[model samples]
Target: MSGRLQHKVAIVTGSGSGIGLESSLLFASEGANVVLADVNLPSAQKGADLIKDRYPTVKGIAVKCDVGKEEDVKAVVDLAVREFGRLDVMFNNAGIMHPEDDNALNTEDRIWDLTMRINVKGVWWGSKYAVLAMRQNPTDEAKGLHVGGSIINTASFVAVVGSATPQIAYTASKGAVLTMSRELAMVHAREGIRVNSLCPGPLKTPLLMDFLNTDEKKQRRLVHLPMGRFGEAIEQAKAALFLASDESSYVTGTDFMVDGGLTNAYVTSIGEPTLPPPSSLI
Candidate 1:
């Protein structure tokens, strides 16, 4: 059977690991040629290599991109178009949660600037350039392609609700992403281009796991999560795939929350659900 993203081309930033890498692999599996953009060239190349080995029919390329820089973000989009013939999806997933990020009074200016550069400005640059390339897409009736693309910006559940955990800079940056995506979606909706923010809750990715290092830290956030478990990268990847594919063609300017009931939580349950059989934790 044909894949959902057959004949499409996608760009996934921060593809060295975490949600970006998983989304890259999943996009390739769905038959889209993917451009893995990350500052860590080796990790991005590894993702490309995996695509080459596992999905022989599709193509994957690694581009060293510091998403904070507009030029770097532009280069990745240009590379995708030059190599794959068109751009279909832009997954702006690169971001930084600086270790020093804390409450407004505790955080330094440099930390706030650094976080904004990568987390907020990166998405801005990615969307700006992706829209330019998407506008140039030639309609191909045979391929079921059009002169438009999907932009999935990685926001967070914190963007919608306040967190007692602080990380004020990170929270502010994510809120910017949501608003930026909404505005971009409105501007490009008539042109067939779609922009949506992918708001994932507390995830089991390095970005979160590294921050919630201690058991106390982990449980503090867990108590508020109605699902009682951190989300996996794969779960977010699947949500992204839906947004990237034509399935979400009409779904633009929306904050697509993949959070496991974190935003809807009031009080916590007493215990976690039983894990399925053969769980590694068992």
Candidate 2:
């Protein structure tokens, strides 16, 4: 039996560790040739190697790409097309946050610049190149062809709702990403390409760990989460897979929140409001 993404080619940026890495592996396992692009070359290579090791039949390549750089973004897209014949999906997942600079006033200009460059401009560059690549293969199903593509950008729930302990720059960048997805979706809809953003809530990734290291901080975060637990990377990966695959063929120009009900629920806790269940739910 063939896989859902059999013979398709995909590029996942920031695929060194966390959601991007997991998504790359999942895409390869589902029979798509994958390009693992990251700022960290070794980490990206390791991710590619994991795919090659586990899915011997699948093809995987690692490219050192700083998504914020237009040249690097174009190169990664070009490599995907050059190696795999065509580009089917682009996951603009590279992002960064400065947890130490929680306050907007306290955050430095450099932190804001770096965050915007990677989180906001990076997504734009990825989409720009992806659009260019997808345009190369304009196919008409009426002509017995399907030559369109999908672009998935990583946003955060913080884009929609403010965080209690705010990283202003990160929030602002994601807000830009959220809007960019909508505008790009409309701009490229005529070309038969789909663009969407994935808004993941607090997940169990290294970025989260870096911020919420202490028991006190962890508890404070859990208080805002209705689920009362950090989400897994695989959970976000599954969301990415859906958006990347034909499963969400008609879904575009919207944000898919893999936020474990954190966005929808008003009340944080379910049981015993009078007494805090644990320090973990600070």
| Top candidate, metric lDDT | 1
True-structure lDDT of candidate 2:
0.88
Off by over 4 Å in 2: 138-145, 270-282
Compose the digit string of candidate 1's lDDT tens values, residues 103-129. 989999999999999999999999999
**lDDT tens digits, residues 95-196, model 2?**
987775568778998889988998998999999989988888745455333677899999999999877766889999999999999999999988879999
TM-score for all models, in order of appearance: 0.95, 0.92
